[model samples]
Every structure is written in C-alpha cells, then in structure tokens.
Target: MFTGIVEELGEVVGVTPTAQDSVLVAVRGPLVTSDARHGDSIAVNGVCLTVVDVDGGVFTADVMGETLRRSALGTLRAGDPVNLERAAALGSRLGGHLVQGHVDGVGEVLAREPAPRWETVRFRLPVALSRYVVEKGSITIDGVSLTVAEVGDDWFSVGLIPTTLALTTLGTRAVGDPVNLEMDVLAKYVERLLGARPADAPVPGPVAS
Candidate 1:
C-alpha cells in the first residue's frame, strides 16, 4: 500500500519492450532507490510496480499489459517526469488516504487557473468515476494526493499549493495532458455496503400465524 505522498520527482530513463505485451521501465529516482533492492514495490505515477532490478540510483520495473491498458504509464517516454513514492511502512502516519496504487481511470487536464497563493486545476472526470468524487474529498492524481476543491457532472477541480507545483509531475502538466486517477477507496467500499443486504437486517421468520 502507498500513502499517495510523492517522495521524489523521477525521470524515465528508458523503456524497452519485451517479447510479450510488457515493457521494462527504468526510472532515475535517487531518493526512492537510496536503500532499494530487488522485489520491493514502488508507486510510479499512481501504479504499484515491483522492482525488477536496482542499479545505482535507477530502478527497473516491468509494466504488464493490464497496467498499460488502465494507466497513463503506457504513454510515458524517456525524459518524462513521474511522481515516485515508496510503499508506506507499517505504523507510519497516514499522510494521505489509503492508496492502493491502483489506477481507477485516466483523466485529462481541462484547465488551470493560477492564483496569488495557489492554483486551481480542473480535470475532466470519467463518467463512470465521477460519482465517487465529491467536494472536499481526497483524490490521487499521478501518485500525489489532493483534495477536491470543486465538482461538476463531468469534471472536478483541485487546489495546488506552491510546494505541490514545484515538487511533483503535476506542475508540468498542461491542458489536454492525461493523468492517472485513483478515487478514495473508502467511497467505493461504502457504495458496496449500501448496495448489499445489510448484515443487521433480521432474517425473515416463518410467516406468523
């Protein structure tokens, strides 16, 4: 699991395709790989990928077909910056919400409005995922967790502080750029529970006389 907190802004060094429908991705993230080893999980742009090899400050991971189909990672190329975050350790503070590093869907930047202190960026929300987004709710975009500042039928906005604009990949995003999105897991769980029969509902007794 990840906390959706970006540890470093890493760059894609290389992308090599394999015989099967998979690609070997090498990323340069000094901070994330300072103590890294094989078999560790890293969240790259909101997708949880297992470390295949670690050399110097660079780490390589294989992106399978399913992940490519579901995320914006497939569109990445050498020199593209990515938000990087190591898995959250046990007993650590939950800085962001519970993030599975599982991309729910992909969205595109619709607009960006810069303010004196912060900026509000609007993104086109997928029709299927729009129901989960709410004003003031948490959402993860490209591995960085942010709060929903406004919501519409097919779009939502988030306020980005200077720190976020300077430290993460979102800072470089422009209109029409695609981003990976993961809605709050708690909302999905609540929806599931509400749709199912309640555990507290009494079983039907034999029709009373």
Candidate 2:
C-alpha cells in the first residue's frame, strides 16, 4: 500500500526485454533507493512494482504484459521522467489517501487551464472506470493523490498547486498525454458491499453476527 505521495521524480534509464512481452525497467532514484532492497515494493507512476535488484541509485523492476497494456508506462522511453514513491510503513501518517499503487485504467489529458495559484487539468475518463469516480473524492494520478474538483459523465478535473506541478510529471504533461489512474479504494469497497444485489431482489438467509 501507498499514500500516493510522490517521494522523488525518477527517470527511466533503460528498458530491456525480459520475455515475449515482459520488460525489465531500470530506474534511477536516489531517495527511493536509499533503503530499497530486493522485494521492496516501489510505485512507479501508480503501478506497484517489486524491486528485483539494486545497483547504486538504480533499481530494476519487471513490467508484465497486463501492466504495460493498462498504463502509460508502456509509452515511456529511455530518459522519460516517472513519479516514484516507496510503500507506506506502518503507523505512518496517511499524508494523502490509501493508494494501492494499482492502476485501474488510463485517462487522457483533455485540457489544462492555468490559474494564479494553481492549474486545473481536465482528463477524459475511461468508460469502464467512470462509475467509481466522484466529485471531491480522492484519485491517484501517476501515484500522486488528488481530489476531483468536478466530474462529468466522461471527464473529471483536478487542481494542481505549484508543489505538485514542480515535483511530479503532471507539471509538464500536455493535452492528449495518457496517465495512470486509480480511484478511491474505499468507494470501491463500499460499492461492492452495498451493490451486491438488485434493489428489487429479495434478501436471502439470516444475518450473522
């Protein structure tokens, strides 16, 4: 699990083919690697990846076919910047929200409107995941937790302050760029618990303690 707080802006140093579809990603992030060991989970742009090896400030993680097909990570090339965050430790303050580092789907930046203190970015939501997002709800984009300011049937927007713009990849992202998106975990859990049966469907069995 993660807090969706970006610790460092890392760069993709290299990508080597591991198998027919899996690729080994070599990333360089001094802060994230300072205490990283083999098997440590590091979120690279919202995708939880286990460390396979560490050499100096560089670490390698395997990207399977599903991850590649579901996120913008596949579009990354050598030298591309990526958001990096270490897994949250127990008892740590949840600075942001509960981020599983699991990318549910991908979205595309539709527009960017600059403000005096912040910028509002609008993204076209993928149809499959649109039902989970809500206004004022937490959402993880490229591993950084943000609140949805507004939501439309097919789009949503977030406000980015200077710190976010300076520290994360979203700062330089342009229109049409693909981004990894993860919706609120709590919302999904609630939906699953409450939406188990149809409204008109009769309940079965007795309640258990």
Candidate 2 global CA lDDT score = 0.95
What tens digits encode model 2's per-residue C-alpha lDDT throughout 1-209?
99999999999999998999899999999999999999999999999999999999999999999999988889989999999999999999999999998899999999999999999999998887888989899999999999999999889999999999999999999999999999999988988977986888876878899
**Any residue pairs clashing in model 2, and if so which?**
none
Each candidate's clash count:
0, 0
lDDT of each: 0.95, 0.95
> What TM-score would each prediction reach against the true structure?
0.93, 0.94
* Overall local distance difference test of candidate 1: 0.95
CA shift at 80, candidate 1, in angstroms? 0.5
Error of 1 at 187 (Å): 0.7
| Stretches > 4 Å off in candidate 1 | 198-209
For residue 96, what is the lDDT in candidate 1? 84
Task: Pick out the ten consecutive residues of candidate 2 with the lowest summed lDDT.
Answer: 196-205
